[model samples]
Target chain A: MEIPNVADKWTSGVNEVTIGATKDKGGSRQKTITVGGSKCIPFMDFEGNPGHKPVIAMDVYDIPPDDWTETLTRPFADVINDPAQWAKKCVEQYGADLICLKLDGIHPDKGNKSAEDAVKTVKSILAAVGVPLIIWGCEHDEKDNEVMPKVSQAARGENCLLGIVSQDNYKTLTATCLADGHSIITMAPVDINIGKQINILVSEMDFPLNRIVMFQSTGALGYGLEYSYSIQERERLAALTGDKMMSMPVICDVGHEAWRSKEAKSNDNDVPQWGPREERGPMWETITATSLLQSGVDIIRMNHPRSVAAVKKCIDRLY
Target chain B: MISIGERINGMFKDVREAIKNKDPKAVQELAIKQTEAGASFLDVNVGTATADPAGAMKWLIEVIQDTVKTPIAIDSQKFDIIKAGLSVIKNEVLINSSKGDPEELDKYMPLAKEYNASLICLTMDKCGIPQDVERRMEIAMKIVEKAVEHEYELSKVYIDPVLFPINVDQKQPALMFDIFNQIKMISDPPPHRNVGLSNFSQGTKEKRLLARIFLTMGISYGLDAAVMDVLDKDLMDAAITAEIIMNQHVYSDSYLTACRK
Candidate 1:
């Protein structure tokens, strides 16, 4: 007898979420990116429709990072201080599908920039890039609540994806995003229940579930990567089995987590066995990203053009 | 969770009046409301009040299909009434249902396969409703075996262990649950299971509450679908919570809203 086909009997699928609004849809983005809606595990072509191919968003910060390693900083060295020009380079030169603007300047311990400054950064990036934008807040709850509302309004009609709303502090951002017509991300600390709870809380505030993405905290390779990998896989399985609360597209912070590792950031002089420091950092990011992609991540926020290029090429081949 | 919304039946006062007056508006509104409330399928029944049951069934199917694309469950005991509704439906449908008796299966099984529709087979036969768990399992296995012998996809056959009113026999609910667990293992890839959920609350003082509580318990034991009131907020909330607690769904603070979405 011929081998019987073995595939999952998926009852439901991930929610399809569109990030930017085009002019016809009452936003200024030249193109909108859609993700999720997969009825099978990522890139299992023979099983079912893979729905949308995964995309990458290159990260640009409102204030230049003073501590970035030489390998990570070299590609955007010229535009480091300007958020708008930095965003332009990510889209034009690096071929980013989307630009993720991080409001690091608004962090109290960092520059303590005002909401107005955050809004200014948003408008400048919007002017510079035509692709969809994901506007991320600095990871402090009180500060994010203080500044995200203004940033949400600044990008209101443009339909940016704004967030980092945690379990403790989703109210202000959730309400503002609903009113401003942008999607938001719900964050959890690698705990699946907490991840689901955050989604439920935001949904209770009446933000449509399809307009939300999920962010389970990332743990880099050699830095509890297995924890991140398992949680993402669990979330995807839950989605395929018809759990709407866990069905939103997932976004991972590859640059933020992978670079934090000593293995990825240390100098060759300090750890020569790991090879050249230049190739080591991007390789760490590339490896971490490729692992998550198999576990069903919809979008990855990456740094280092070299790692971004390699990951993008991998995505093209798989999809 | 394949929720079959049960409000469009002509037994309801509003639906009876709508059928008598030949008004499609009331029936159409129920179809849209139930779809919004997360009904995977809407049960359309021309109740006992209709003088021309087949005509009413056809009209109900047309009105519902015109308003929404959600699938319909042609819910009538009479094969002719089911045929009337099936002739006009443009989308996938569920023939709800057949008994385990050979004659009944012989008639409806082929029609179900011919229309490429799914079916709900009751765990009862020409001998009548099975009182014990053993008889219920026997009838359920008979339905599955017949479906398989006919080359029908077992997945398309839904086995209902046949819920009974708590007021009639308080012991029946426990027996029903035991039969449900047994019925699931009747075949290799067992047929999906559901209940006419409202049957458990018949003649009860707090009818909705009784039905809601029983359905939640049944879900914990692996019930896959139900024909129930989707519009009852409390009942729907209980269903969502039960699925979450069972880990069939991930827990969310606003799980109630998420399930509807």
Candidate 2:
């Protein structure tokens, strides 16, 4: 008996977005990373061009994290106080493809850190790490508007990925990213329509569509992960079917969402049946990242070194 | 939706004057305007405006191509004029029609394949446009079968279930909608469904409203392409909004502008 061919052919592929710039391109990074140009869904490579491999971006914070569980903090405890060193450790030790610097301390309720503080932190990270950077905002719309613009200027020609601009408050960051020659991350609340809408809003500001990435808010394993998985799957399908509005590469916050789940964060004493906290947490993060990978996520924002290693191994084996 | 702008046809007064005077400005302006208004293809017809229609078609295509890069759909009942227009096209081409009759399909199918053009197969024959749904379906099925036998890419073949003026026959529009639904089931990944949109509103007082409403309804029943006035903003908006509602297009606040881009 002969095997039948059932491969599906698609008309369009997800847009290829390259983050970071090298000296020739007017940025100081050692290398640039490109993602999201798959003509087929996640791993059915026989169907069409598989494009580029998905990469991992480990998270670092400007200030020491106040609420991260011990399982999440143990690996990075040595350099947590210094943003630049933390970023260098993430890239050099754990083999992160990029560094995503979270400006958490700049939020008024967090520590009310100044724009100057944020800019200095951005500059230090750029100097310490040769890898590309993803500069995330503090999520407070008003404060992000004030601090991110200065931070964008601080890393002006580096071609970093600056983001988390939502539909309601994208203009400030969008203009800054455009002027600074950086790509942007448009966000929505896991609704595919709003996800597409935010991209349109950013695009209307005259920002180039190829320089944009999408973040549909993620849900961890055993939480609303199924919803995130399905939404990401739907987005990949939409991209394959030629919806230009939704065709940007997808980035999921796997570590943050996964660690927030009780299965990862709760004390082992509190839930003795759920196994040890150290192993449980990284497994949770790895499972979340790997599950979302099957739905065609292009960049994963992860936290734990063990989980990053596990997921990276899975990616290498699959490819 | 694949909007084939119906403005460049010589039946329109401005286009007729442009063709008569041999002035490229008016025709070129329409081409630019229609292309900017989100027309996927601009339909060109030298309708009764010139004794030398083949000559006029070649001229119109040259003039239009000078201004914009939108695909051209050579629209004429006479094969000679369509062939003439096809000869001058430098970009993508869509053959505006071939009758559902086997002989006509036999002629147009090879030409379409040779030019790598998308051919619109009208659900009509020598007996004229069918008034009943069953007759229209039979013709549509025949067109689909002929396309398959020709080994044409199904996606490139557009099946136009002919539409008549609502005033001439109110019952026909409803029947056409039924044909639109059944047309999808003709084959796997069925031929692109299309219609000559303005035909439904011809000779009616409420032309614009009827065209918009019928287009919105037809879209709900799976009409993917139309030869209509792209200049009519309301009609285009209605069509685009229907596409969004049907999840064919991803919606945003500025979707109307985005669709044009």
Candidate 3:
């Protein structure tokens, strides 16, 4: 008996989006990175076009990350205090395709860093690294509304990927990104409907659809990962069937979510039966990222150079 | 959903007058209006209003093509008329349609291949429209087999179960729904299921309401395309909402606007 073929024929593909800018494109970066444009589900190259290989954006904080576990912080200990040095270490040593600058310190409870301080940090990081940047807001709506526009202006012609406007508070960042020539990230919380709804809300402001990226707030390995996984899978299916609202490239905060889990951050004494903290932490982060990759995520915001290396190896073999 | 706007057919008053007078205004307006109303393909039929249907089809195709870039479905029972319309088309086209009988497939399938047009095949053979689910399923399987033999891409083939008016044969709609579910199993990446949606509510007092309800039900049964009124807001809303509920489209507060966009 002969075997039958059961390959799916998809009508559409995820929209391709490029971040960063080179000199001719008006940014100082040496190169830019593009993601999305998959005609099939991830790694199903035999069936159709699995457009670009998934890329990684390593996280760098606006202020030193005092809360990160020792295992997570050891890799960048020498440059931990300087945002620019930390970003450079990520790019030169770790092989990150992009640098995601999280403005966590600007929040009132964090450091209450001024708009000028945030701009200075963004400029220094851009000066230190040649790769394109992802400038994420501090997530305090009022503070983000105040400081992100100035930071957006500081990188105006560089064409960075600026983030994370949800349905209720998209106007400020959206208008600023529009003026700065940056792609915007639209976020929803583990809900596919709101994921698409935020994209619609952002695009309604005359921001082009192709310039948008989607982030469904991530859930770590043992923390509602299935919810995140299923939603990502559904979004990919929707994109394959030509739903424009759900077709933007997806980004997940693997590093942030993975580290937040107790299994990843606990001290050796805290989880003695779970094995050494070194291997356990990186494995948790790596497994979270690599698992989500199967659901067609285009860019993963990761931490820990070890997990990044492991996930990169996995991607290399699969693609 | 692939909506084939049914307003351009000569059986309608405006289209009949447009065909007789060779007036491009009425036909072009409907073409533009239907395109705005989200018709994926405009169905062009020079129904018995003209003495020379082939010439009328050619003229209609030219005018509609000039107005909008939406694909045209060359709709006519006569092979010669469909051929005339195909000759002048400037973009992608669909042949709507050929009967499920092998002889009809032998004639129309080659033309569809040559023109690179999607083909809609009705599941009614020379014995006529099947009244029972079993007979319709048999004819539908034959159509799929013939399509495979011809090496036609199954994704481009649309299998229509041939809906009859609910008032005329109340049982046929239920039978057609069963065929809709079964047709999907005939192939991987199954041939798109379509219907002449207005046919289900013909001559009814509540024409729009019946058509909308039936269309919503058909969508749940895996019907992906239809030949219906794109100009009817309520019907279009129901189709969009059904697709969202099916998870085919991602939902938003302005989903109706988003789907059309």
Candidate with the greatest TM-score versus the true structure: 2
lDDT of 1 by residue, A48-137 (tens): 788898899999999998778888989999999999999999999999999999988899999999999999989988888899999999
What's the iRMSD of model 2? 1.6
Q: Model 2 Cα displacement at A257 (Å)?
A: 1.4
DockQ of each: 0.56, 0.57, 0.72
Error of 3 at A194 (Å): 0.8
Arrange candidates by DockQ, highest first: which order? Answer: 3, 2, 1
Best-to-worst ranking by lDDT: 3, 2, 1
Model 1 iRMS: 1.8
User: How does each model score on TM-score?
Assistant: 0.88, 0.97, 0.96
Instruction: Tell me how candidate 3 scores on lDDT.
Output: 0.92
Docking quality category of candidate 1 according to DockQ thresholds:
medium
DockQ result, candidate 1: 0.56
Model 2: what TM-score? Answer: 0.97
- Clash counts for the predictions, in order: 1, 0, 0
Question: Ten-residue segment with the worst summed lDDT in candidate 3 chain A?
Answer: A2-11
Give me the overall lDDT of model 2: 0.92
Candidate 1 lDDT, B103-186, residue by residue in tens: 799898999998999999998887899888888888887888789778888888999988888898888898877776876777
Task: Identify the runs in model 3 with alpha carbons over 4 angstroms from their true place.
Answer: none
